[model samples]
Target: MFALRMSLVILVADVWAKTPFMSEYEFSRRRDELIREEREYAGHLRELTADEKIVDNYLEYLKWQEFIATEDKFLPSVGLEGVLDDIVNSKVFKTLKKFPKGGNMHLHENHILSKKKMLDIVFASEDFEHLHVAVDVPESKKWRLDFFLNPPAGWEKVKGNPKYTKEKLLPHMTMMGSMTEFAKVNPTNSARRWEEMDPMFSRLGSKVIANVNIKFKYLESYLKAALEENVQYLEARSSISSRLYTLDPDPKYNSTGGKRYIDETGGEYELQENIKFIEGFVKKNPEFIGMRKIVNSYRGASVSEMYGDMEKAVRLYHKYPSYIGGFDMVGEEDKGNSLLYFMNDFMKMYDNTTGKSLVPFYLHNGETNWPDDLESSTNKKDPVGTLQNTYEAVLLGAKRVGHGLGFFKHPYLLNKLKEHQTAIEICPASNQLLGYVPDLRNHPANNFIRMGAPVILGADDPATFGYDHFTVDWYEAFMGWGLRLQDLRHLAINSLKYSTMPKEDINAAIKDKWEPAYQRFIADIKKEACAVDFDASTNAPAISRIAPREGPMKRSTKVYVFGRNFEEGICKGVRCKFGNAVVPGSYISGQHVSCNVSGLRRRNRKGAGKSKAVGVAVSVDGGATYISYDGQFTFVRNL
Candidate 1:
């Protein structure tokens, strides 16, 4: 012990002799300089105003408290399905949702409406009684809805059927089943996920939304929902090949129950009528800006079939240049034929539309995790790997690349993408749910941004994932990637700037619509963030102690928080944090608030008992700041 003490004294003397101490002023100056550097790097895209910084700081605090500071991982780390309810209830997500998301450049036409919205549309239809659902079907074909004059065998009328109620039908239609549990059990079964998802469009699209009346209603609802989320414009990819029909028994030009074409003879009356309907919708809802369609051909289609789609797409673009935004091949890149497989068709289309700006290609490229050289002669159905698809997409002059998850793999291609100004449609939520990224923090798109690639947020297929708006995508991108307010603003701007909208229209959208909305959003965030002056000593809330401070693990225990200077009407933003698990605190009066303390699992450490003790705190400024109580609360395994 004496030798150890002598050694310690000698070490301390050597450290003191070698280390040069700085004055308090110099030390503080260096710290401030470091903060400035961080702020400069974060705000490289755009500078935040004073109020915007306040909002950013508050958001940052919430992100830390919700993710980093928490004992158990919550969101952006776990599977999206597991924390979906948490996301919905998040004040951070709710606030961010109100911010203007300029446009959704990569959504599919069939997935515009949520599962609930689909049910609502069907339930309110004139032919509601005629809607029949196939029961006793395979798991893949569960609850398939269709319109029939006479209900077929194994099919039952949904209007009066208790079993076919919307509540039950929703689970079948949506991809939100026990996926969280499934992911936990079988973590790498992305193929199974795709197997379940492949038929979703067919199940809903051909049977119900393919109906012209329902299609129109779906589009209308889409516009309303987009506006609700403050998304100004939409660019929807569509095959335009669903044999559209009407359920009406008495139709003017009735054939095959009033069937019609969306793209037959490019100049078909049905196509014109649909365009006219969209125009009317835009005229009425000017805030919507407008909608544009990107012609789609599944990558799994045969070469000849793909060529036909290419021809049809070209013809549509020629006939209705303004309405047709661009073209893209839609399907799983890893499971389908590569962009190189349809090179001839694309080259022909490229030659025809070389000088044209409207019919540009927005290809799905570099969407897989496989290495570039993973090829096989036997398995031509599924490409060995698809990261090399980036080469063909950029060479063909694709306007944007869908997913582009593997773009960063090839530094040359990444530079080319930047050179071509092709934006990457980084669908973080879709990527997470689909298993390309189990934890969003490790997504490659973060590197894509850091490397100066143009990145735009997209939801891919919101309906299939059981969500409606693009805000969740934005939320994932923001939180998962540690994005600043300026970074988000840059992304929103990129959504408009890289869109297929004409130069004048894009300017109008950014200057007239988005700019004003962004200003208002920042102002609103500031107002809410500064609602309570907790920083002021007179108004600062001080937690004293909690009654029944101990709770059993894996259960919730209601605890009364005794505090002073609690604001009146603190119901909106009051959060009582027990360790890292935050819950809503009910304000009873100036001195009393109650909250449920969740008994999260405790980690076993050397020399530590079964009980875990942590500080309890209260935050009224949307988690911007918290006042800790004087005592620690214990969570016990058996209480």
Candidate 2:
């Protein structure tokens, strides 16, 4: 049996080596094709510029083109696996990856998970001993050790009639049921069927408790993955609580309603522990250069609760000047209490006690465009209605704005943003995925840019979105905005320049580090431009060309005159004259013609040249006689 198993393994390895799955040749071919297509498109664009109308129309047409093209319908014949590989291997992607992006300004701490780690967490849980279940939930019927072995001394009464039976629990605990049966249950609510969940499974691993050890582990794993992708800095948003310890229905941490209560020290200690872990990581990995904090409030929290949390975050920022960078009001912006409702209180607190302006603000301004009435009544403001609140925040000195989709509606507010030079952190793909914008092309950042507003791209919860930094957010920015290479370079530089790093350090880094790197890239681009002939078609001379002759050419001159009565007249060649009709012989008048001369030759009379000439005066009043040339002449009868 052992020999047969070894033979089978060897056979499988041989098969895998010969298959396309193991080799990147297919991906490389697709990437080359895309580059070829881009070059062709560029050439076509050059030709189209001869007619500005066509170019404008085509650009307008591309406005609705979806960004990323990750869906199978938009994918190349090779499929998504190949498309991802091609993107990762492309020249543009390689160059962008090298850019020193300063900080991730919109990351959610809880959402940071990888597929491998998630599966490991689920599969490794000790509670699913005989069951093939991955998680513990009500529908999963998988009784954790706490529920079965140590059923909280009074659980029988509290839980209300515990129908505990091995047969009843076994089916719920196992994911061994057929696919048809699994399809009937909602995976979101059913822990055993997590594998069927699409986006959730794609981004994160199984849920873990919010304890010190779990958070630390998550951070380490998250940092490692981020580093692999060349992310140098992060500004993650998280809440401070002892929910994991209090999750157990013990009398010490839990009250009658199974709610977990946290003491002041407990919250502070947890935050301190996280800070220590971050510092230690930075020490170990010098490339992990920047870190900042963002305090988050749950959407369900009351106004007072939010104020208290914001105060805690402010205090932490004061305590750790270098680590805690800012305060953010997170959660579902469409459902939570509006920031405007609490602005007065926060202002008082900042003025009265904090003294330091608490922390710089980076608000999630508008993630939805639903009508104010349709939105949760408590929040009561959609994207457009929230414009006033955003403007007020800016007036109150917000450093940056997050997802300011409705800024376009208020031109004055947009002008304010431009005047202030505040940058909007746009997550185009995230907005599209969440249905805020149906497609990346419809995003308002395009208008923002056209109006000379500062904008930067971010991957908000990239892991949850089932996309990488390169393949998702950055890609969307490129395709959606139709941004040129220079625009992208500027955005990259802005990301670092506007980050929460200390002023001195930021200045030093920009001068000493990023400038050199940027120059190198510029030099490389120049070299490429020189090597490639951009105007090869125009290089050859035209066939029907005339040769130059070394000789002087003669010049000519001419003069002409026209009748006064005629509204329109044509004159050609040298020295010509015209006069109103009259029975007269030509007279010698030295290149001037009188209206009439009685004889062929007549002596010149004094002031005769100035006298009114007799001639027919054309008139539209039924051919009636009329004066012409300032009543100087009259028309004669035509018999």
Candidate 3:
């Protein structure tokens, strides 16, 4: 009797659950479940749309794998042990050198030229006698040198010193050093002690190469390297503080003391002259689309000092509106006064001005550690250093945020940046070495991409880290973040789009320059990947194309087949291979099929990509199918 009752109850419960007798709670629960599913579907849709269209890029991935396999984990990039330095010397760098990076938008004028190039220029010159070493450490074989084009007596002692030979002169001529090596010999490096090196490094360029004519030569050498690296444009960031070395050392002050460089009146005339010089540089090197300037104030300034610099920056911007791309506060962000500290001054200046300041502020805001300790910064008040700095940058109408290391602390900034169409100048190599970010995989740039915020890779202080151009940053973006050719293409395009150039001109450059370059790049990738010639005139087989080319799904992914024409005998028991791995469990139809070799794998234990493919095949039996494709889906791991 109990069993019979249970069966009858099930009938009633089933009817009630399915129809009119259902509880309000049950209905609400079902509705919420549907809403959750809908949200998930929408998210997936967004992800699919977010992927920049992938072109089969085998050669680039191969280069990436070799680099990853051989990298030294313990090597810090700012020192000799750096993996990046190794990457620079590798075949991967050779491949990367050919990549068409849009522009170097965050270069330091004083730091762009390599140490070796500086040495070469000095050694070849008749002014070697004028070359002077102010500091010498023979115990460690390190020295600091300066030059005076026209001697003001007692300058003869510079070359007379036996401490500097031809071999030793290069190190003394440049501030490039292995930080790790230096740390071993000298115990702890206090800020005051390290401050000594800053003036030395600064003086190396300003004093040692202290000729106006040769300064122009330095710019030329810098541009040549950019062209070779396929970086077609530049927006060099220079500090107002780096006034041109005066031709005449003042009669009163000692030459070696560097007292002669200090002039009571700031050198605006020299700056005007240099700006004119750059205009001439553009005329000569038409190959570089056009190198623009971004005026900067030294961050070492006090609040009053920052205001003064800003005033000077504004004047420069107004005077050379065409060449002056924007204005900035360039220095160590943490060590300097926060952008907020001068907010009132900026506002007052804005209110007093006649119209919109042509010098849009592109502040180097949030390039800090944002330490947990209260004593993190010189101004201990910066408890949430990263967030506050970013907030101020947003308020300041920053045209672009430099090094945006703090953006991670506040994710809302990503959306804010995207909404404003503001670009973030990502200095990958500098960030890695500077301790703001140690790993590119976990970097804030990931958030920028996901949120569709604009990003441009820059070689910030390349000479400091020993890089010639932006290619090394490109390499890191690829290897460090698991970026693809398509991703790189977008970033390159973004650098141009979010630049301070007018929208119309940027669009023109895209149409006439960047698009054509992209086509050539894609064509090269295809030619390198498949042995078959990619003819523009001919319609290649539809089978050569594939979709959803990368992913979380890309690694050990399922490749759904696509093609034209069907033969029953060839289709019977069809099998497919991705590299050397056979598709383990697969489903096949006339047009669509599945494979389990992931459809992507950059390297095997032997260091060959498992996804690499070459041409046509056919089989009539269970282990066979008519198949043809071009280029492997080079797997992206840990993305």
Top-TM-score structure, candidate number: 1
Clashes of each: 0, 1, 3
**lDDT values for all models:** 0.74, 0.48, 0.59
Candidate 2: deviation at residue 450, Å? 3.8
* Candidate 2 residue pairs that clash: 118-205
**How should the candidates be ordered by TM-score, best one leading?**
1, 3, 2
lDDT of 2 by residue, 424-487 (tens): 8887655654445544566788777656677766666655444445334565566556665445
Candidate 3, superposed: residue stretches over 4 Å from native: 1-55, 71-81, 136-142, 149-162, 171-176, 181-200, 241-281, 351-358, 371-375, 379-387, 531-639
lDDT of 1 by residue, 1-639 (tens): 999999999999986874463432234344546667765543345555667766766566556545644327657777777777777777768877898888887888887788888899989988788788877677666567887766556777889888878888887776665344655555446666666667676656656876666877887898888888888888888886766665545554354433334445433555566688878987887766777888898977888999888888877877787788778888777778887877777766655445543367888788776779974223455454577788887788888999888877788888888878889988888887776787787888888776667888888888877766678887777778878777888888989998888899889989988898999998888787667454453355777766666665657776777867665324235678887878876554556667777667444322346777878888765676778888877766555
**Ten contiguous residues with the weakest lDDT in model 1:** 21-30
Off by over 4 Å in 2: 1-95, 118-209, 242-264, 352-356, 371-388, 468-471, 516-639
Candidate 3 lDDT over 1-639, as tens digits, reads 999999999999976776651433334345546666754532322221111111323443354345556565523223322455676776666766777788888887777887678767766666566576545333232344556545343333456566566565554433335344553233223232233334435534655544553566777788888878878777878766554453445555444443345333465655666667666766776545667778787755677877777777788777766667777877666566666667766775563456455468777767765542322346654334434778877776678988887777777876687778778999876666555555555677866765567788788767744555577777667765656555676787888887777889788767776677667766665454344222222233245454434322244544445553222212133466554555543323234344444434333423433323333232213454445566444443332
Error of 2 at 339 (Å): 2.0
**Cα RMSDs of all predictions?**
13.7, 26.4, 12.7
